[model samples]
Target: MGLVIPFDDKASDPGLEALVALVAADMNRVNQTILARTGSDVAMIPEVATHLISSGGKRLRPMLTLATAALCGYQGEGHVKLAAAVEFMHTATLLHDDVVDQSEMRRGKLAARLLWGNEASVLVGDFLLGQAFRMMVEVGSLACLDVLSVAATVIAEGEVMQLSAAKDTETTEDAYLAVIRGKTAELFAAAAEVGPIVANRPKAEVAACRAYGMNLGVAFQLIDDALDYGGQAAKLGKNVGDDFREGKITLPVVLSFRRGNETERAFWKRVLEKGDIAEGDLETALATMKKHRALEDTVERARHYGSMARDALELFPDSAPRRALLEAVDFCIGRAH
Candidate 1:
């Protein structure tokens, strides 16, 4: 039998709820900005954009922008615009990612690329990215603009890096970490850092927010890597073993491949490197991963980063925002259970 990690009821969890409630008002404004900016005379732009935007993603990146801004004592509407921009950037990336991965589902629904075609999905992603930059320009903070723009560049680079390394069982942990840092964590770091930048908080506070976001983003991706093998489809919003099917070299795969014996390594090369997956291949992958404790160790790595994320916030005094942020870390790691 495959390893079965017990699932928790996410709806009853107060950790994310507290973060949501804390950012509710600003998030409303951010939502309005998103709606307003998504409109265009070209009908397909709205069609494709709204398909993914309306999908039930938690909008965690934008929430980070709002939460960290508030935590830094920001008292203005700029963060709302910045937050919306962050969401647009994230949504744009998802559209592009779906096309790149040839993914069928996203956020529990058909991927925009699948429904609208890859061309439309890619174009709409570009439209959203253009809108994101427009919103960033409107915010009139050169520093914030620079942070997000650089993140956009870094994300594209990361995607290319991952693509080059895809299906290669020889992928190292350091290379994997570099890919995730560029593809995922850079935006998180920018999102959090902008909050302090807009709030005119001290440089130290800005660095703290950036550190917290960077570490949290790493933990978030690691948990997701583990979940692709262990988590249920309903909670994951995608099929279990999607990464394996796609031949993606996530952390769990990296660890398992590195730890496997000669025959086990040959199995990995056939399945992942050659994409010769057959019936029961996923089960074998999971059983091999379990034998090596790959999933367990991947979650352990996530917890290490989660600890760093929480410690990053130690520079701040205790407050509702701080506590909420801490709980957010737990919420992320708890998904593995």
Candidate 2:
């Protein structure tokens, strides 16, 4: 067996806990596959990978793979390997993202790049990508490969778009959403869709899972952006003002900048566009966002997407997995509050 993350018995969300319990055995095998596949003879490869992998994360993406497969009545063992592949893909993205953002902390610890250097982090990320593909190939599902490979391409495109858009105050809300759809939602959609695809579910159900994951992923990223400014540091796993400091153009900043007065606009341009941030600028930015209800509005938009996610599952009959998936949308939105 692989390294198992101990589940907290005292889950506050009943639905989330139930979903975890429902897939407990499958997740165990998925964990084993993750640990097995991530190993490498290269000393630094496993070191950097383990540093990030062992760090605490909810492992929700892989869980989505497993849960969606079970939801479609899959009895095959292929889901275990596919679930691990999904996790590797997610972890690879995180490693690459930390490097791109020059982020210091990840999952409440020093980033892999910080400990292992950017060169090592990037190479290790490549290694993980290789492993993810290998696992996908081993599962031998053309549908799975198509979904995941396309997602890999979309995620790269999104990263490039985000790099180009960074510190560019003129980036529009629509453009921002586009970037996140590629960067975040594409993988989520692929993960869920692959589950049903491998399970041999109907085209309609597969499409529904894709829609659910796509909307849910958008909602998840929106909440993450909101939490960057409004959430507690302990709960958020990163500093509250990391986005502001990085000059990342997120939805809240777009709304605030578009609605602000001349002085406020100058403030945003100075800090975000020109990277001339002052000591108290984060406080000023927060105050401006609050005045414009930018954070609140962002969460409201997440709720809209969350609603879409919930509605996508209406095609599936009510079950523990269905209810849990519905509540998962609420869980995504609840992070900002």
Candidate 3:
């Protein structure tokens, strides 16, 4: 379906292999169909779209869309259209985010802003967003349209909150959770929630799938935050210091700040507030994390929600797809990038 991205290296986890295969096959099919529909008049739009869409993302959002559809008893292919819409919305946000952050790079390549300038990036992002809304209308489900519209709003709100909250070291854990829910988890929730909505399933089932996506998204972001310093910069593709340099407060930083003593607190205040974070500050931050067992605590929280996600999937039939969906919880929690 696409290049294999092993979520975990442990040889014993065959379930992860199965999950990755299914998710990748389903996601690639959606991507191909969606890009082709962009048409010739928007040639430059598709060109820049190709740069971001073909840049080798794992397509977790689309997978969630498909999995939720299957879990909710959808036997048709409409899930593919919805999944593609979910991905388009996600990619549009990424384009806008890079511009807003003035980021020169993403996934180790020149960002759309860096390669094509802000006007192109912003316009292309708008095109993708409009395309997604058009796809939702084509689905001919008012419920699906409603879910996506709300999700789009939530994603935008999260981005705004993140921009405002990043500079404050006093950023509380609750605030961090809210920002991620808006930026990352809201789409995950919407992607999954739309599945049942499209299928016209009972409300409780839709609620369960939505819960699964929400918890899974939070867990996924938590691990991603942990990997900022705990993971290899080469493996993550983006620079390791990006979060610190951008002053983005994430789970690891929240936990570290919670446990910081006198000097560590001062370090956070100066670096984040003054925007003068130094090379040595990174080591100091890492040490603070180690001393307070912040990483371990955050990992535990991720797993707890991962467990909730698996539990939510129990409403599904005991099929191969269901098993694959269940395994995704663990994969999302442990992924390095």
Winning candidate number (lDDT): 1
**For candidate 3, lDDT tens digit of each residue in 26-106?**
777797877775554867888888898888777878887887776677877778888888988989998999988887777
**On a 0 to 1 TM-score scale, where does candidate 1 land against the true structure?**
0.97
Per-residue lDDT of 142-234 in model 2, one digit per residue for the tens?
A: 989999999999999999999999998888999999999999999889888988999999999999999999999999999888888877777
Clashing residue pairs found in predicted model 2: none
Higher-ranked by lDDT: 1 or 3: 1
Q: Can you give the lDDT of residue 112 in candidate 3?
A: 85
lDDT of each: 0.90, 0.87, 0.80
lDDT of 2: 0.87
Deviation (Å) of 64 in candidate 3: 1.4
Residue 56 error for model 2, in Å? 0.9
Tell me the number of clashing residue pairs for each predicted model.
0, 0, 0
The deviation in Å at residue 200 for candidate 2 is: 0.9
Q: Between 1 and 2, whose TM-score is larger?
A: 1
Q: Which candidate, 2 or 3, has the higher lDDT?
A: 2
TM, every model: 0.97, 0.95, 0.91
* Residue 312, candidate 1: alpha-carbon lDDT: 96
RMSD in order of candidates = 2.2, 5.4, 4.0
